[model samples]
Target chain A: AQSVTQLDSQVPVFEEAPVELRCNYSSSVSVYLFWYVQYPNQGLQLLLKYLSGSTLVKGINGFEAEFNKSQTSFHLRKPSVHISDTAEYFCAVIPVYNTDKLIFGTGTRLQVFP
Target chain B: DTAVSQTPKYLVTQMGNDKSIKCEQNLGHDTMYWYKQDSKKFLKIMFSYNNKELIINETVPNRFSPKSPDKAHLNLHINSLELGDSAVYFCASSQVVTGDNYGYTFGSGTRLTVV
Candidate 1:
């Protein structure tokens, strides 16, 4: 079974500081990667997704993630973040061939302190 | 306008009671799914329906039943709810045309609290 691992449970950062949320998946088959953000008491919103494209994928709200095939990592990055960026971020993956189901990692709470 | 919406944004019921969380989608998507988010915020897929057909049913308990009246609606009915069933349930929908950039549009979750 394909699984996603998000090592960090919580990450605290100051506003305007850069941040990186690491995500790794256990799948040798081709897969589609995605990042979703959830505000307090809100639904999950898509931040970005990596289909079959370049390694670096830019998402909304000045967030970007790089898909490293060799390392099996798709780490999300933001050069500078705002207090509004504070939310629970989830990393998800679905195998290319079997795209019916999405496996999500335990979310990482991004606490952007002002 | 909301793409996906679940009713009873907050539901509080006693144990052994039966409750249902209604979900509907206006996105004209072909696939809809139910996901459960635990207290620790770990999400796991419970059920998925595609074009009104059952596709993915995880290792969820038999007490939980999912009904799809159409491709646009997927409602979850829980019987004999237990304290462990207290969690946020999310409803999502996707078009799944080619599945290249597959992503779901989720509804504002229904927070269920079983007392």
Candidate 2:
């Protein structure tokens, strides 16, 4: 079984300011991680995913996330945020070598202010 | 061209009513899924179909049913809906041949409101 937890329910930040949205997961075996963003009343869009290899993964719209095996976390980070970046972000996981559907976290709402 | 599309973008219905939402994908993928996002913004997988076969069915209520007439089309129907059934339903498609069949293209979503 696998599960994901997004630490922050809501994050308020100023424009051009750096921000981080924390995510952690619990799994009994190896897993694949993903970060998805959803605009208002829209479907979820994949930002990035970590299947293997490097711990650091970059995504579209200037977003990035680092996979920490020790901490069991894949926190999303952006050097600078824009008002357009305001959206709901979700962290999800799928067990490796297992035919399971993606399990998503509660989601974190990023509110970028001017 | 849209990769994934669902009908009834916004549906308003009363309790005990029955409704159906249709989904179609042009991605030529073998697998499709249905997900529900509650008002709390928590997404949960409800059903998945591969090659028009039922693959995964979660702990959804019996009132909810999924039908896949073909690999490219999946439809969801609700019978005797309740107020708690209100949610945003998303239709997604992905390829199954690859290891990471998790690469899903999602539909805009059908916001169903039951009063």
Candidate 3:
């Protein structure tokens, strides 16, 4: 079985400040990692994904994440953020060889202010 | 255009009433999924269909049934809805890219409220 844990339930950052949302996973097999962002009253949008190669993946809206296999973690980071960046972010995992079902984390609420 | 779309953006109904939410994906993807976001903002997979065949069915009760008539459409029907059933339901689609599974395109979501 695969599970995703996003440690930060809420992260408050001032505008133009850097932020990082931590996500860790536990799986017995190889898995695919992804970060999804959901704006207020909107569905989730795919931020980025790590399938194979390139530990670092850049996503939309100037967000990036590094996949650390040894840490069993994929943490999303941004050098700077705007007020519009406030949203709920989810970390998901899918087994590489088994079903393509996505197991999502509880979510991290990113609150950016000026 | 919206790639994955769901009908009834907001549904407010009484308990014991059965309602259905429809979902459609224009993208030529082989997989479709239904996810529920609870009040705590936890997204959990309820069901998944691939090419009109059921593939993943979580521990959801039988009252919550999913119908996939074809590869592009997946509908969820909730019978005897309870207050706990009040949540945001999302529809998503995904496909293979370069021999690996890619991320999903999600619908705006349907907010169901049972009073």
Model 3 C-alpha lDDT per residue in residues A35-80, reported as the tens digit of each score: 9999999999999999898999998999999999999999999999
lDDT of 3 at A101: 87
Ten residues in sequence with the least summed lDDT for candidate 1 chain B = B95-104
iRMSD for each candidate structure, in the order shown: 1.4, 1.9, 1.8
Best by the DockQ measure: 1
Ranking by TM-score: 1, 3, 2
Off by over 4 Å in 1: B99-101
Off by over 4 Å in 3: none
- Across B27-64, the per-residue lDDT of candidate 3 in tens digits comes to 98999999999999999999999999999999999999
Ranking by lDDT: 1, 3, 2
DockQ each = 0.77, 0.69, 0.74
Q: What is candidate 1's CA lDDT for residue A107?
A: 93
Question: Which lDDT value does model 1 have at A47?
Answer: 96
Candidate 1 vs candidate 2, DockQ winner:
1
Candidate 2, residue B29: lDDT? 91
Error of 3 at B30 (Å): 0.8
TM-score, per-candidate, Cα-based: 0.97, 0.96, 0.97
Q: Report the lDDT of model 1 for residue B70.
A: 89
Question: Which regions in candidate 2 have their CA more than 4 angstroms from the true location?
Answer: B97-102
